[model samples]
Target: MPVYLSRTANFLLTEEQLKGLLKRYDINGDGRLSKKELQVAFRGLGLNFSGFRARRALQHADADNDGFITDEEMKELITYAAKWGFTVN
Candidate 1:
């Protein structure tokens, strides 16, 4: 299970914690997040429209337009996700 998905529902996730949790979804072990991986991450965060959220995240954070969120882009992605104030239990 994704780390965030396993967290307690009342637990408020910090940006740093969200960052680490998101990183664990890099299924290809490429150290980067693809849109699909991001979708799953958003779903793990208990989002209803994960697909839309993932696309928005890419748009907001994929600086190179390469269709993947690399390490450098991760900060921006985290910042974006942080705005939602995700709470996982």
Candidate 2:
């Protein structure tokens, strides 16, 4: 579900695809997303400031304050990602 975008093209990802894409970055196979994992995921999406973005993502989506993005919190994360767009450019 990793999408490549041109500078002039805008691609919007479906929630399911976005979710799957993010889940694929769970390096520890923990069924959750840690800050580091999220940094990698954001980098994969061709985003800058991935570390900062990851921290913000956790802040916005880590509902339980557990420092991880559980399945239950994925919707907010997906929304956040979508809002920012997955465009490579």
Candidate 3:
């Protein structure tokens, strides 16, 4: 499914653009997202995920199990979010 409500907007983003947008949540610009960063990212998108739910998100998206979401891993997250009706802002 397309990631945004406007089908045309979905066509506007390349995977690289989408990936770069996810990195905006990396407050430290560390090239990865921590649990806390993930929390803010979710909050920014109006998602109420936190606590155990946030941890679960990290686990699902942290493909390397490194406790952080890399740029590549962010794709998994974006796909999952799109499936759940969430879109990157």
Candidate 4:
């Protein structure tokens, strides 16, 4: 017999969770995080970084150049952020 947990218990909003997870960086709440948004988030965390430098740092992940980090781009951004030198944490 297949015994499954309740929907609430099994439900894992991966996408929504990703959005909410990065909410701090998604200041506008447009479901995406922009360079400016990232800068703001980092600033809030006491990470001293310049506006121009911030955008450039995120450029590595912004392959499309749309000026925003999409859900697919989030992975790269996260990895890049951890290794990027622009951010002074």
Candidate 5:
């Protein structure tokens, strides 16, 4: 499940990382995370989350809108997170 995100070769996440993020944010267990779902999930995990912020992050990653973010999407998301100073782990 690890995905390679190439952007100056600085941002990449392994499959375990992806699974951790999914398990952290996939509150609904629907295999995907909506804006609200992400918020709830993160918050439940003791993360200080904003729905709008998480939405933007999810939108950046969920390219196919297939509801769930694929491994590729997760890679892109890591890149974005690294670029924007969001938590990448």
Candidate 6:
């Protein structure tokens, strides 16, 4: 049988959580982090997300041609800030 936990059991994320996650991954601190940066973070955190796949995943999300990604774009690509090695709340 499948048991559903209470709402409290589910992790909820706040803006600060998102910001912290971004800051953690933002190695160069250029106000943004690129897919390569995320790849490094994922590797350090023991997560699985290929660099090529990650780039492909972030196709339209990369709003600026500068190559680095912004927080808003990451959120949009992941659909939520918590899934891509980021903490929620």
Q: What's the count of clashing pairs in each model shown?
A: 4, 0, 0, 0, 2, 1
Work out the TM-score per prediction.
Answer: 0.78, 0.81, 0.71, 0.61, 0.52, 0.56
Q: For residue 39, what is the lDDT in candidate 6? A: 70
In model 1, residue pairs whose N, Cα or C atoms come closer than 3 Å (at least 3 residues apart or on different chains), thus clashing, are: 7-89, 8-88, 8-89, 9-89
Per-residue CA lDDT of model 3 for 20-70, tens digit only, reads: 666798999889889988787766655565555458778788888989988
Alpha-carbon local distance difference test for all models: 0.78, 0.80, 0.68, 0.58, 0.58, 0.55
Per-residue lDDT for 1-89 in model 6, tens only? 12111222444455545445555877777767778876775465455655754565456567765566776666554443244544433
lDDT of 4 by residue, 1-89 (tens): 12112221433334344345456677666888777787776565345554754686568888788888888787666556545332212
User: lDDT winner among the candidates?
Assistant: 2
Residue 50 in candidate 6 has what lDDT?
54
Model 2 misplaced stretches (Cα beyond 4 Å):
1-12, 86-89
Candidate 2, TM-score vs. the true structure? 0.81
In terms of lDDT, model 5 sits at 0.58
Preferred candidate (TM-score higher): 1 or 5: 1
RMSD of each: 4.9, 4.2, 4.3, 10.6, 6.6, 7.0
Regarding TM-score, does 2 or 6 come out ahead?
2
Clash pairs, candidate 5, are 1-15, 2-15
- The alpha-carbon deviation from the true structure for residue 32 of candidate 6, after best TM-score superposition, in angstroms, is 0.7
What is the Cα-based TM-score of model 6? Answer: 0.56
lDDT of 1 at 76: 80
**Model 5: residues with Cα > 4 Å off, grouped in runs:** 1-15, 41-49, 84-89
The sequence of per-residue lDDT tens digits that candidate 1 reaches over residues 1-89 is 11232333754555566678889999999999999999998887678788998999999999999999998998788667655654323
In candidate 3, which residue pairs get closer than 3 Å at backbone N, Cα or C atoms, i.e. clash? Answer: none
Instruction: Quote model 5's TM-score.
Output: 0.52
Candidate order by TM-score, decreasing, is: 2, 1, 3, 4, 6, 5
In the range 10-66, model 2's lDDT, one tens digit per residue, is 665556667888899999999999999999988887788899999999999999999
